[model samples]
Target chain A: MKEKEINFEEAMKQLENIANELEKGDLSLDESVNKFEEGMKLSKKCNDFLEKAEKKITMLINSDGEIKEEEFKIEEN
Target chain B: MEYNPITVTDLNKYIKEKFDGDEMLANVLVKGEISNFKRHYTGHLYFTLKDENSLIKCVMFKSYTTYLNFIPKDGMKVIILGSVNVFERDGVYQIYAKAMKQDGLGSLYEAYEKLKSKLSQEGLFDVSHKKKIPFMPKTIGVLTSNTGAVIRDIINVSTRRNPNVHIRLYPVPVQGSGAAEKIAKGIEFMNENKFADVLIIGRGGGSLEDLWPFNEEIVARAIYNSEIPIISAVGHETDFTIADFVADLRAPTPSAAAELAVANIDDVKETLRLYNNRYKIALKKRLELMRLSYEKQIARPAFKNPTQKINEQYMLIDMKVKAIQSSIQSKISEEKAKFIKQIARLDTLSPLKTLTRGYSIVTNESGKTIRKVSEIKTGENINLRLVDGEKKAKVL
Candidate 1:
């Protein structure tokens, strides 16, 4: 199966669809197995995305129509 | 240095003239606490303004009193702008107030209200125009003073909730002089640059006068026109500014704004975990059902004992073979009986059998049986067939 470049939200949505399809229990065993595998793969991907997300704070500077990013730090109160 | 003695009315008039002639008395600005304040039937305000040691009668006539932002009341500290002149009838000096204001934040409050209502009428504060804040904002912009706890509190709260969230601070003057313009500029700048998903425009708690910049029209418009969703947290929970009304969302404080900007990643992770658990359970159940159905199919007769079905077919074939064999045997027996009957009849009609019953048959030399001889023209050889013997003779 060609897994396209899917975002977190899309992945979650597809996972939900797969879950629903499986839950309905109207599919053949082969089809249900395929859906379960696909859904599990998506769930793993979503979890990975959440875990690997790192906080990045950057200040945007527009100089002469050019936008640049600089590291932003919170000043100690 | 008057030589002529003047009457009491003349003396009082002269004193009033002297008081009016003084420039300081003509336009006096006095700060005192009000006592015995009264609103006359004609909409005039009569009050006594006094300090610890000095007391002066003050009167703001209906003409100027109508312009006053607040009604004067006893014990309220106020500043009166009017001329001090002697009242010839009372023969005492009093302040004829042209205008009056509370000692602190009096005029500023009026200005704030004026701008608030003006902006409100223009639909800037309408809920329909307010944008919804993103459920999960990646970047949070801060438009507040750089040298204060506002930014720090926001950062602390945001980072504590979701360490992955980004904070972009556009340090602006939160108060004093041109702070309103700078704050507005900060909002626009963030919007133009697409700096952040949401913005927090505010400062920590302060007096109404100190927080006046947030009430400025420019700041309110900035918040209203902001393409980026803004959370106005200008002061404490009790403090409501124009920015609060125009903002897409209002947080009670800067810290609260940060809390609204980003959701906890742990909660999101927990949600994912929940989904995962649900899918797993559903899949398991599906597999279990399928397995049970498969078990039922496997338990079926054809699947359980495949040869038993073949055995059933064999039994049917055996019965058919026996039926065919019985019909063939019966047909053979019937044909044998018919042949016996035919042979018996043929025996009765046979000449040999007739000979056995004392009947004989004769044939010529040509071996042709002669049924009856009308005349024998010449003697011919003949043969006779009897039951047990045959003889040759001449026909006579």
Candidate 2:
């Protein structure tokens, strides 16, 4: 969801779907391999995405219908 | 000197002007029980305020009734601040109330109830209209005052839940006049830009009046109409705002809203790992099962020694061919014997047999067998055949 290109939820759901398909044990060995590879790739992508990203915060301002965003930093209390 | 008498209206006007001139009457604060309560269709409240011994007429005009937060009813004790004056037309003295409060409670609670019921009846709080909050919101648009514990709490909570989650604070007034409008506008702005998948709108705890903007109709309507799912966290727990009812989800506090809005990245990562592990285990199991079945098939004798199996089939074919050839040979032999037997029977009836029995078959020169002596020439050469040899003999 953060990247929009990679919807984390969708990727997770698809990975789960692949897991289920593999667990059903009806697919040919070749098909199972393909699904396993796909699932592994998705898992890696999600892991990297979560691990590499840092928290971002921005203060928003609207002036005359124009919205501007500025980096926000928490000040010491 | 005072012989002339004026009209009742003129006398009443004089008394009213005198009462208006008195500063004490102009600004009076009274606490009494309400009786003979009636509301005019013109939105004026008329009631009699009385102690045990005496009573005074009070009228809160529609203009001043705007300040009333509760519906005044009979027998309800109240403190009213207004001016006492004479009504010139009716020749009656009444208090013009500017504001009224319930004896022990502020009227804000009643107003809150009133609006809550009104909006509830309108189905603004219908569950079916609520949008589902996202499981993982990339950005959480927080609508609250920027410089407060509310914002700080939300940031702390959200970042703790998922450090990757971006927070966009659309700072808005949590209370005071026109605060509702500002909040509503913030919601609109967020929605317009598709700023966040979920919005957390709220403030820190405050008094009922301080949290009034959240209970406002405009803010409620804004929450209702927002395309993005909203989590309302107005004031502390136990404080209910109309925004809470209309929002997709309600958190008791700003921190709770943050918790509600963000998905824990670690948990999600763990889930993904589980899925990966499941895929690994399942696929490995599947491969192992296939390999075992394949190995079992391969372990069969036919598969183990393919050449021997083929040689065995060849040997079977050779045996079958040999058996067929032998059967044919015996059949030929049997037929040959039958033919020999038939030949022997025929041979016994043959003239050659008589030859073999020491008789001869004689024929003339023309190779015709002579059956009687009359046809034979005396000196004609003839051939005679015995069984084994031929003799030239004259027939006598």
Candidate 3:
């Protein structure tokens, strides 16, 4: 069964799904509205997630045992 | 010994019988690496099959060669099924090659080459034809085997990168016969149904044979023709396929492709917040600039010295009135002096001035001063008007 409450990735995926469904002109009005609401929630969640995140740079060892880190400067323009 | 001259047909039949009578020439199975293999101008094959020790010329005419699916190449190991026969003209014994089957290096490499060349010629890998992946895809369609780690990895990476991403798995066969067709159909079906904003068609790393479906002409064409942008993640980074070439975007793995397709919800929200803050800051700065200008305008003399402007106008009006009065006075005095002088001159020359000098105007009766005899009657009453007094007189 598909989860009703979606996580950030799931919500994004659902939002895209909703958009594509709307674009295709397949959904009924009621369904479209529900999908739109879901999409909005997902969009909000995405936005909120981004807003809360700081432009942080850190280093860690990867699965392949290679060390990687954020290397570029954050340009705040 | 008497030898009769044979007819051409008899001689040909006699030579054919002699060739067929060779015991060692019939029912021979020759093993050799194929060389000089050519599909002749007439669709016949002319080739030399040779072992390290010896070589034999061979020919499988067009009628026999038509059944083969793959093109023959040089240095291919094959076992030929044919009888050995002598070419009458060359007098050399050779294999009349028929029914060739691959003995080693199975047809996988041939299949790959065939499909690659076919798809390439059809413009499937044209850069101009590739669709751009959406900036933020909300729904990602995954086409792969459902049971494998491929789908799981895609879901995990997509969800972790952006929890809101919606994934729709369209499970398909990724290998063996009919797999390419199914994968192609999956792409078409998603596009037709509008299942996802972007599609991820991929599988985990595998051998070339395992990855062959992705490299199929059908799959490559389907990916190229897809209306929706596709991300190909068929194998490890080192592994390349026709699907990778034809896809809009190529990822090293299914997880990486998923990561690329969706934007992190947190990142988007943070950007929105930053934009809002910047907007507010800009608006405040604009208002402050307007206020500063307003204050500057208020500090100007026109705003501060309002009564001074009125007072200046009043002073101007007063100065004009005073100047007017003085000029009028001077004009009036000059005129009065001229009038008096004129009056004195007129007193000496004019009758009205003479009257003012103590002479009086006269009229006949009816209040007229008598000046001529015809204006007077014998008995009449007359009144005389003077500068200071009026008198009544009787005229006879």
Candidate 4:
């Protein structure tokens, strides 16, 4: 299966769906195994989202008609 | 007038009467900060209202002070509504306060309540309309002051829970003149750009006046129309704003909002582990059941001893073969007895057999059997055929 770029929210949703399907016990053995594999992939993708992330803060600036992004720093107050 | 000069008491009473006679002085509203506030044992309040240049003594009786929602403290800004009059005995001008409200915040609270009820009646705050916040958001949009503790607190909490979360901050004035418009615009901008999966709009704890922008109708409507679910965390936990009612979710503080937007990575990992185990167990059970059914099917008679079924079919075939053979044999025997009876009857009628019993067959020279003498003619030559031989003789 082709892997696609998915957000953490979407990946979690898919993981939930696969878990429900497996728990229902209506799937064939082959189908159940396929679902297990897909679920594992989604789980890894979601984990990677939290693991590989670097803490970042960005500000949105509206310049003319276009929006620009700039790095923001928090000052000690 | 100088010849009939009155006493000092009369003069003081006249001045007090004049001060009271003025309608403007009778009903006055002043804005200042409280100083030297005191609450007597009788429940009456005595305080001084002062600005930068001057101060004035103010008093609120127990009856009116009982209505005050907050305890008055020195250095707290307030707006007092009452009458300014002079006491004849003390010869001092003082304010007799009827009611008091927080400075610059009284009207804002009124507006907040008004909008809250109006939106509530229109079902904007109905739980049915509120969208569910996603368990894990990729991007968290923030609408708040750019250089404040609100943004920093949200970042700290969210990153601690899940470091991969992306936050896009829209720097907008949290209060003052045009802050409400800018705050609403920030929500619209983020929504139009589809920048985040969920949004957190809020500010740190502040006075009611400082948090007025969140109470504005514009900000409330913006939250109501937001496609991305919004979590409102304006001011402290005690503070409630119009945005809170209209938002999809309400958080007591900016940090709480962050916590709501992201699931803890460790907890999610545990859930994934659980699902993995469940899948394995479910598949194992299914396979076990399938194998059991296979064993049961093979245990049936048809498969357990297949030759038994085949042997039963062979016995039926043998029975049918013997029945057919017996029927054919009986039919052959009946046909043989009938043939013997017919042969015996034929022998009784045969002339050859009669000759052996002393009877003969006579024939004329023409080789015709003679059965009557008239037919043979008296002088006709004839032959007599016995069982053993034939003889020529005269028929007379």
Q: Pick the candidate with the highest TM-score.
A: 2
Second chain TM-score, each model: 0.63, 0.62, 0.57, 0.60
Native contact fraction per model: 0.58, 0.88, 0.04, 0.68
The residue ranges of model 2 lying beyond 4 angstroms of the native Cα positions read A1-4, A61-77, B1-107, B300-303, B339-396
lDDT of 1 by residue, B1-396 (tens): 869878999999999989878998889888999999898898888889999999999888989977876656788788889999898987998999998888966677789889888998999999999898876665788888766788888878888888877788777778899999988888888988788888988899865767989988888888888999999998889888988999999999888888888777788778778777777787788889878989999999989999998999999999999999999999999999999999999988887877888978888888888887753335888888988999998866
Error of 2 at B270 (Å): 0.8
**lDDT of each residue in B271-369, candidate 2, tens digit only:** 987887898899889989999999999999878987997899999999999999999999999999999999999988888778777898788788898
The C-alpha stretches of model 1 lying farther than 4 A from their native spots are A1-18, A25-77, B1-132, B147-153, B163-165, B192-194, B204-211, B236-240, B362-383, B392-396
Superposed model 4: Cα runs more than 4 Å off = A1-18, A30-54, A62-67, B1-32, B35-74, B79-104, B117-129, B311-396
In order, the first chain's TM-score in every candidate is 0.79, 0.77, 0.55, 0.69
How much is A58 displaced in model 3, in angstroms?
33
- lDDT tens readout by residue for model 3, B1-396: 999898766666677677799776677777788998887798888899988988889988888886764456797778888887767565566788778876653577677777777877888878889887886665678888866688778777776876655677776889888999989988988888787789999998765667889988889888988899999999888888889989999999888898788776667666545544443344445456667879999999899898998999999999999999999999999999999999888777876665677877767656545778787776677777677777877776
Model 4 Cα shift for residue B4 (angstroms): 38
Give the alpha carbon lDDT tens digit for every residue of B145-193 in model 4.
Answer: 8887889999899878876667889889998989999999889888899
Worst 10 residues of 2 chain B by lDDT: B102-111
Chain A TM-score, structure 4: 0.69
Better of 2 and 3 by DockQ: 2
Cα lDDT tens digits, model 1, A32-67, are: 778878777777776666566567766656567576
- Per-candidate alpha-carbon RMSD to the true structure: 10.6, 12.5, 15.3, 8.4
Quality of model 3 by C-alpha lDDT: 0.74
